[model samples]
Target chain A: MLPRRIYQFFLIYLLGILVLLSLKYGLQLSDYVIPGPKTLWQTALEVFPRYALDVWNTLQVALIGQVMSIVLALAIGIPGRSTTWFGNFIKAAAYNVQAYPIVAIAPIIFILLGDGFLSRLLIAAMICYFPILLTVLGVMSEPVADVEHFYRCTGRMRWQLEVKIRAFENLHKLTTVIAGSATLAMAGTIVAEFIAANAGIGYSIRIALYQSDLARILVALLLIGICLSVYQGLLEHTGSLVKKAWTGSA
Target chain B: MNGKTGKRNSLLAAAWILIVLTLAVAGAPEGRAWAGTLNYRLKWIYNASVIGDLYASGKGYFRAAGLEVKVRPGGPERDALRELELGYADFGVASADQVIRAVAKGAPLVVVAQLFQVNPLQWLYRTGKGMIRKLDDLKGRTIGITYGKNDEIIMRTLLAKAGIGRGQVEFYSVRLDYTPFLRGKVDLWPVYANTQAVFLRDKLSRAGEETALFVPGDFGVRFVANSVVTSEKLFKRNPELVKRFVGALLAGWKAALDVKHQKEALAILRQVDRDTPLRILKTQLEITRRLVMPRSGPPLGTIDFEGWRQTERIMLEQGQIKAPVKILSCLKPML
Candidate 1:
């Protein structure tokens, strides 16, 4: 084994090297956003207040997008297993949407829908719809022949049976699909925001690039990271609540 | 199995609701016939003097043309040529080097109108640091060159003119943010004649610090700085549209050039450069106008072959460009 003192020194040296490198190239991302260092701190501080509302707008869009994607997945998935047509159509739509890049479609959406919450919402929905739909379809269509036979023998009403019993059975799969949709939806909103927004994190980044303020760019990235973390935390919290509710009902 | 399908139907309804919610947010666009149509990419950002000119052109004259020019202010990602290539923009405000490089790379971009008659490439240093009085002293000095193809090309040429060889001078790619010149960071940096230098002076004036500016034009490297460029396809397809567009722009330039229009142009630029003081902008515009305003021999919008050749030779020597580009093909006459 290496000596303890030597290991400590090596670790410190590596950390020091990493710190130096981050400082050196850290400005690269910022240079893409803001151009020069002139009055950078002041400019960033001033702009931060304006972005509060923009961030709120982004969050709202992402939340709606996640919900929509989850819903789409279930709708397509449920009927898909019954008939190949339903399954193929849903799968094809998802794949086709994914095939075209978001950047290409965003401007057109802005043109058609006009620049506002609606255009961004549609862009986000388009993004979230495919993945969730596919997931839900797969989960909902999973082997349930035994459950169906039991209900049939009992002559239970299909509506009461589906609502009261069958829906609760696939809780784990539903939770997983929803989690994935949330992540995908966030990505969609940000990418869509890049094209037409006069405000939001995307607009801020775009302006930061033009001005050449690297610090502001990094700040925006940091803000996105925070937003993602909070979103994930919320997703997990909601998942637990869902699990608890399902357990209590059962 | 049928029960799962029932639940799925309800989820689909939720998705539709989301789409409707988004529709609710997209209200009618505010004001004007030309709104949301035009997109413009600037060569740089709000701090540059050209922004005022662009703003004046867009809001004042170009609006009359029914063109709502969205000035996409530039930074590192503001590759004017790339914007055209990606179809993100209709037109771009770029430098000659950008146009030349794009053309070299098989991009069919043409310079529509010349904005700056003289380029603003200069070395800014402390009043007395090393033997930097003449170009030759630039040898072995560490120079800070931020970004821009022209900055890199011109600095190389200025060094060559001073008899400095490759490896004679160390280069720091970091921009001079008026930070204290650390020995390891850089020795000198290329500064714009009006903006960066003036910005530094104002900082000094406000905080009671001392600094001096050295203009590159004084040392004999004068090339046109900002030029209006569009795709060759656009030019060919709508020659009259291009002419009409340029005609309106020239009027904006003429207005901006006048002493009276300085206040209006500065106000427009301030929308972008909230950090840039008006007094400093006026000083920069005055100095830059003097340096870049057209001379008697060459008419406005004229590209000097000799000037182009000098830049071409320097770029070739420095390995900035592999092959020399003929400058005449790049020019689009306004008349």
Candidate 2:
């Protein structure tokens, strides 16, 4: 029997061919000329190098956004969870903000913060922040009566206790939050770049669409997929390292 | 902890503190001094109409009227009236026929002004492709048209004129793929004569591709395709703004026609149109100039009332519109 990976690849390839066939013959469709077979080949050759660069840009934005989100989420979650007075209000506000559509928010962000790396970063951070915040808040809120009692008996200062016990103890939760936020941040960056952009994958997609060239559009999408896969791999590697360190130390 | 660890921790803590401080300081809403910004959702991509917006901006006509037009280049996914209805755009340019559809559907949009006096819809093919001189020649031949109600109505009318029934001709959705006809995949394709045809012939001359164009006007089908428009409610509220905008845009259109400025305008068009060729661009410019400056009374940039009536008659006959539209009511007289 063929290897499972090869089998799956074959299946996917067959399905793609079927789709192309349907678009061509099944619907009795008239194939468009501009981005037809010849144009597709031309674009495929021209776009490969540029596509690699765009993917790099996308990855860089996503990374910065993910890191910012994790930091902001931790800062918000820790104090908001520990404090009683504004805890519910802060959590509700965060949730409400998370509910706003990325597409609707992108234009406002673009206007308020001009098209810079910082603006796109902020959009990515905003989109990714909620998942990390919620996850960190949930993890921190988990009952740790024994640890609280130990800290109380030791008469440790709040800052010292938080650093040694709370922060160090929740490494897994933080890593998971970072991983999830990184994925969301990538999505947000794409949305932000789609509006008021001069470069990046989203801008390329927009240009392709205006010219009504489907090949470049598909190529852009393919490049994005590759970029996301690489990012996910990095996230998983970092996550596993963190997990290993935490486990080994214990 | 080591001295290095202490320094790194202090830097991180300071950064966090700085972020919080910045957030607090930036939370206050700034006063709206830039309130005169007019968001315009264009009907299509960076084409002639989009260049018109650029020209209008460059000439400071919009600023002279105390407005800053933000021209948002639109696509197939965008709904211009929907953008206007949602207050995303102050006004937009779209088909006069769309105005009838919008009004019938209870959409609060009205025609504020007209742009093109004649629609540029045409059936283009490579010459000597199986006797395609008349409409009946389209019978049993593969025809390329967009899969829209309006396109269908236009094709059906043209087919009927050629003494061909619906079943005789095969309707294939072109989806703006201009090359399929050149590749011999289909016999005929509908195109915007000013835009697509120019791109095909002029832009790709070096590529050695050839095309022959047949227009709907030549076939006794005449309609105005694009018009400057605003919401009915917005029109009632800010009639002066609409008037100023129309005047400014007319000025922009006039500037586009100037022989001296045509090169500058073409340069801007070329910058935006990476795919279109120089031949196509010049062809579009000439064709558009002819249509806009038809050899008749009221030199150029004038909407024909009879043209609107003819469009409505065709649309109504084809069941594209429910009720008859009054052409005079649709016209916003140039002040």
- The models' CA-based lDDT, in order, is 0.63, 0.68
lDDT of 2 by residue, B34-134 (tens): 25787777788888645666678777878887777887787777757756664567778777666665554445666766667667777777655564667
Candidate 2, CAPRI quality class derived from DockQ: incorrect
**Chain B TM-score of predicted candidate 1 relative to the true chain B:** 0.77
Error of 2 at A140 (Å): 34
lDDT at A26, model 2:
29
Q: Highest TM-score among the candidates is held by which one?
A: 2
Q: Backbone clash tally for model 1?
A: 14
True contacts kept of 1: 0.02
The superposed Cα distance between candidate 1 and the true structure at residue A68, in angstroms, equals 40
Q: Please list the residue runs of candidate 2 whose C-alpha ends up more than 4 Å from where it truly belongs after superposition.
A: A1-250, B1-35, B130-133, B202-210, B274-279, B297-299, B325-328
Compared with the real two-chain complex, what DockQ does model 2 have? 0.02
For model 2 the local lDDT of residue A156 reads 72
Assess candidate 2 and give its lDDT.
0.68
lDDT of 1 by residue, A1-250 (tens): 1244344444444443334234333422222222234334454576666665666678788898777766665666566645477667866776787789877676566557766778778878878877666655565555466777788788984744553344567777667667757666777787667655555676666655543344566556545655665676667668778888879732
How many residue pairs clash in all the candidates, one count each? 14, 7
The weakest ten consecutive residues by lDDT in model 1 chain B span B26-35
